[model samples]
Target chain A: MSEVATPTQHAALAARVSDACRSAGMVGAPYPGAVAALDTLGYPTTRQERWRYTRVTRLLDVSPTAAAPHTAPPAVVSGLDALRFTFVAGQFVGGDTLDEGANGCFVGPVSVALARYPERLEAWSHSDFATKEWFAALQAAAPQDGVCILVPAGHKLERPVLAHHHMPAGVHVAQPRHLIHIGDNASAEAVLWSDTTAQSEGMMNAAITAAIGDGAHLSLEVVQDEPGTVHHMGHHHFTQGSNSKLTVRTATACAHWLRNDLHILQDGTHADSTFHGCYLPNGQQFVDHHTRIDHAHPDGQSDELYKGLAADKSTAVFNGKIMVHKDAQRIEAYQRNSNLLLGEQAAMYAKPELEIYADDVRCSHGCTTGQFDKEALFYLRSRGMTETAANNLLVQAFLAEVLDGFRPEIRDYVHSVYARRLGWS
Target chain B: MLKIDNLHARIGDTEILKGLSLELGAGEVHAIMGPNGSGKSTLASILAGRDDYEVTEGSITFDGVDLLELDATERAVAGIFLAFQYPVEIPGVSNINFLRTALNSIREQREEAPLSGKDFLAKVKACAQLVELDGKLRDRSVNEGFSGGEKKRNEVFQMAMLEPKLAVLDETDSGLDIDALRIVAHGVNSMRGADRSFLVITHYQRLLDHIVPDFVHVLAGGRIVHSGGKELALELEEKGYDWIVDAQPTEQA
Candidate 1:
């Protein structure tokens, strides 16, 4: 993609995407609404209020399906001990880490799922998004290779599943879509991480559509630790069933331009949903998270907390909204966004909003932005810690609110991974 | 042993400690009683190497080393501890983690290997017991949402754990009731030894009744105008600081 690409160029790129789908024999099949949406909505511009903090014109010219850079499969992810489905530069590399899903779980490339379980693949291809979710629609229109994970009803996985994405050298763009469905009474946890050793800076516009059945539980963690030169935009949509539980933690460790949109629908009564995130952006890095929770049924509950740590000319944007439909009575929703600015030029924009139509429901939202406590810093330094150590401890303490939301089994592992990524441990 | 000679410190050109001089001997408990804004806290903070105030002209020597040249952590590793007048609340940093980090850092400063987890936990338990601190508080954030009494006790617990050679108590008795004051005083007294010393700074002489300072110094007008033995605390308490502060100008005139 060329920098300073125009919207008209993106409109042409949208046409190229439609033609690519047609020639690839996916014209009538796959998700047509997404292709239609992309054709109608092109891409966002800074003129829009939500796109003020992010700029995508530089990435608008990525030639969809750029050939994968010739490279070896990454071996570093082998120790994750999950059903690993590796994708490099928008193409599926043969899995040496895992061949097949274990114990009533199905994990494989999306094309394989399309060939084997076409009906289920088609069912989850559509997103429940009404607004112009440009990235999600873009991925759907050009998803050449991705992962599909399914946990059949009445089955529980003993291990967490991991889907790792790596972009090899010289690739300009990669658009991969993922589908995860948890059947009734099923439970599983999955972690997705994206990285790059590639030097040719580009973008990755990925999407994941997850559906949870009645009384099922699913926990998902998305870790973005790409080099600061790369751009990333991701969308995750979750639809829940009655009494089901869903928890998601999105951690943006590093990226030059990172934007994530999480849309959750509590469609069934008594469903519980939790959304927690931590974003640390430093030195020209930009991270944004836009989350919306829709309480569509009575007695549904949703809680969200997102914390940002920005330093050294970086910026963090958070907009979390909870909407209670007119018929969705007895809903309980809470949202909070907190930010800590550690550098002189570091900036943060946080908006936590609540819209309730039900009179008797409990709803609250708050946002806070500030620098680290000077008194706390002195207290730590006076106890024999150097300035760096004290700063590390304070940042860790700031992020502890979101870190405590992970499950017990993955809590320590996640914390260590994040700490290492942040150069704190 | 610590010595302060002709110490003069200020913040933003306003003098706080003006040519103040004092000496602390090993095992000696000295109390510096002064009113608010009289530089009581400023003296303790300066001893702890707080950088907000610049020592305009003075020298502070700790154990025959120039304490003025050392940083805050260096001062801490060199065995100077300051119990803050208003303890800070650090959310999400558990007391256990903070204490463990501090203990290991101190050991590293001393060129000693870190202790095993079991040994460290045992030591922490003993120190908590010494200060009558609850074990549950150990897992909670440092001083976050803690009662005033708990925060003060945590300070003493920290003092017991680090076992500093010189303990500077800055208003350790400010918000304490009679009972808390006694417990805190006992915690401090228990750690007193032939090689350990204390410089207790308080606005009231009541704390000296429990800790029983060996020397009482009257700090007024940014100087120690009077020095006496322990009985002097009662005399100052009865007559109040008015007479002493009142006499400074007349004597100078």
Candidate 2:
């Protein structure tokens, strides 16, 4: 009856996970300090403020009894004109693996990239989450295959890359680590999508790490559309150099229970970062998005927006923090989180934390949670729209600001997923 | 085409419409003018099946069908349209897209086919022209950042698109300039036909001057205090409602 996992239990879980990864052919040294961090942080519990709304006690039971098959699922956004790669259960299945040697760009599986050019990826492969968060440490300790994109200095990728990881049907576990390093003045676009079948049931603990060099620009779109009973934990981290720009957009189209911890650090002057995310959890599902951004240098700007809705007894949480370092002057940071409760029993928790030490900085944040506008509903109804149609329109309107930021293909796919789940399609 | 007999309704414990009765035949435009707090807007809300008010004693029959039984959406599908006094501003829903959905929804409910994209666009163009609602406003979010006159004109444009049988103008002329008022009345006059009826609820007689209703009824104390021809609007406009409201019976009071 003790849901709180002890230190011994956490050690046993880690040992079992490493063995499972080794058998699954993930043979590489763990990220530095990951094993020790796992031991120190231990498994997260509701007692911790960071894990207050996200209950990881159920995740303790996620020890996969057997490995899931590595068969490839169907392609997503197939019509999208991009270099596509497919992975199943954190193993590369098929796609165009672009390996352009050490000095050139390389877009392929992380395992392949590690074996091909270890020194090239040595500096940026590790993320802060590996030494800070327990789940992230666990993922790094027993990492699996995910897409790895490395662009050399002053180079722009001609085509975007779509890395798709699918979780097949079984009680399995997959900890995939996607890495991206955009060199100075280099630019690239990529989409990291993970999906599962309705019959699929397991855990997908994933991590995404990116390093944007000076004057580099990297745009990323992340879509998590798992419709099964899987519990997903995502650790997404990004670091930007001087004059670099980073744009990250995430759409949680559907999830059973998901928690996304996104952190970004502007390590140099004049770094610009914009991150926007949206989630709609219905039918007793739960979703949490915890985001933090640090403006460590002067003249840096960051804009963060997270909007979502909880419907039909579902619960959603959003906590955003903005940290401006002591010498990070002339920084402009704005964060806003808005949520809608579509059901009487639905719940939404939103909080914004800002810590500033610089005297000449502008930082502001606002969080709001409310129900559907009755006046808007009545207006639509009076215009001849059915209740369902009106509600669908309202939901679409509420999410358009966030969802519209995604690529058209991804935007339509995510919106359709929401419609199908909500019975609007 | 419409009949309200002894309609007694209230929001919470304060009764707004007490013993209100009225009748309107097909093809007739009836204008109801009264002083402030005379249930002019309340009666319009009740006819459109707003859930904010509870009708304790009433019978609203529209074309021999019980209007009270339908929800607001069903009422719209049943050919009832209410031009809100204050139109709700819905962000992110384009005006054209909203009209299309509404038109298609009403058609689907009436067992008709959906409109084709080409035909729908054509309809939008024609309807948007009726109220002088610009092409830019037609593409923007519904009522978002629209001027007061533009919002009122948009309502008439939607009315033109829906082509409802019973149109209730609930203080539609409250916040409109002279030009916008003429445009709104013109749109309403153009839509009038043998199969369509209108219940124009207003506080000013200026709107009636343009639309020229067939009958003018003064609503006071939630009841029909006076009924006359179109000239009654002129009399009330010149003399004000103090003469009519003061003459109401004391039984309800």
Candidate 3:
């Protein structure tokens, strides 16, 4: 795909893109709507509220580069026991088998779905809400070989599905898309790990859309621990159906600059959602998390808590907004953001907003930014723990409240990754 | 087991304990009763190796080792324990875990094997009963949201577990009621033996009544100017530090 363009340049780029799609024989009968949506909303700039804290222009100012074709796949340790799908850059590499004991569980790359269900592809090829996001736009315009996870109705998978995205070092831009659809009354747990060891500086723009049917339960954990020289932008959309529950735990560490935008829609009555995150940014890294919980129906509940530990001249930002519509009465929503600064040069900005139009709703938000407790540190040190050991224990304890909520396997992986990022064993 | 000779300490440039001297033998319990600004806590802190208090001119020897040369934890491992007047609250670390780590650290310093989990739990349970601390409190974060009496009891509980040779009880009885004080005193009394000593620093003589000191000294103007048998505690309670201060200059002259 060509580089993103300004408004004046957008029209020509869209025309060229449409003609290219037609010439490549990739356009189907339903491609008009998706293409129109992509054309109208090119990319978001600093003007957009959700993209305010993150500077998209700085990331896209450089020339675009694609990932190398044949890099070695990421090394996966055994005993994961979950259905595994590996994606390199934006292309699917391969996968292992799903255990027969997993009870009708299926796992495969997005190419498998593209070959089988051509129509569902046309409907989801573009995102209407995130079309303006520059990375989202680029991801939409680019071709990707991502992952598609489907759980049949009323099927309960014994093991979680593990998807790993490994980006090799280089100044390449990757756009990977993931679509997860859980049928009615189905239950599953999924863990997505994004990692990089490449010495090259690059950016990764990833998008994930999940739809949970009525009475389904989905547990999702996303860990972002890419190289310190890389920039990452991720967008996630979750739609919860009636009487369903969606639990999401996200942890981001060691990115030069990372922006995660999470949007959750409660479409069914009595639906529930939980969003938990922990981010530790050190050195000159910057991490920003923007989350939105939209209570579109009555009798729904949502809770969000995100904690950050920043050190060594790093900066972090957290913006959480919970919206309860007028008709969405009996909605209980709470949001909290807490941060600890390890170094004097480190800083954090947190803003928790509640926009509720319903009279009978219970909504509250709290934000705190401060340093680690000196008394606690002294207490630990006085008990014979070294200063470094005390600080590590305190940081781990602070993050354990969030990490302990993750599935056991993912929790261990996240713990190892965070330990490596913090340079602690 | 512990000796303080002409101990003069200062916080910043202002001297707190000026020329204070005392000696404690093994199995002896000494109570130092004084007024609020008499620097009783300063003596305790100085012995515990608290960094804020600088020993301007003093000599402290514990078990024949120079106490001033050791850091806090080193002092702790050398059998010096100070039940802090105001114990710090450490959040997120359970009390049992903190105690275990502290105990193991000291043991490691001595090149002793660490206590096994089963043995540690039994010891903790036995010590909890001795200090009247509920077993449930062991699972909670260290001293977080603990009541004042509970904090005092927990201090004694730690003292029992560590079994320091020279235990300095710095105002451990200040914030406790009669019942709590009895439990704490009982815990302390149980640990008394020929191989250990106690330095009970307090403002009131009421705590001395329960702990029963071998000797009671009157601390006036940062120095222990009066030393007598346990009767001196009753005398100070009756006469107060004013008479002692008033009579000091004349006695010196």
DockQ for candidate 2: 0.90
Chain A TM-scores, all candidates? 0.89, 0.98, 0.88
The lDDT leader among the candidates is 2
TM-score of each: 0.93, 0.97, 0.88
* Docking class of predicted structure 3: acceptable
For residues A130-150, what per-residue lDDT tens digits would candidate 2 score against the true structure? 998998998999899999999
Error of 3 at B118 (Å): 1.9
Q: Tens digit of lDDT per residue, candidate 3, span A3-54?
A: 3347755444434433332332221232334445565665655566665556
Candidate 2, superposed: residue stretches over 4 Å from native: A1-3
Runs with alpha carbons beyond 4 Å of true place in candidate 1: A1-6, A12-30, A61-66, A70-80, A96-104, A129-131, A198-200, A407-425, B250-253
Best by TM-score: 2
Candidate 1: docking tier = medium
- Give lDDT tens digits, candidate 3, residues B11-102: 99888988989999999999988888889888887887778888888799988999899877788778888888888887667899888878
TM-score of model 3 (CA atoms):
0.88
Model 1, range A336-360, lDDT digits (tens) per residue? 8999988899989887767888787
What lDDT score goes with residue A223 in model 3? 83
Task: Please give the range of 10 consecutive residues that has the lowest summed lDDT in model 3 chain A.
Answer: A21-30
Query: Regarding lDDT, does 1 or 2 come out ahead?
Result: 2
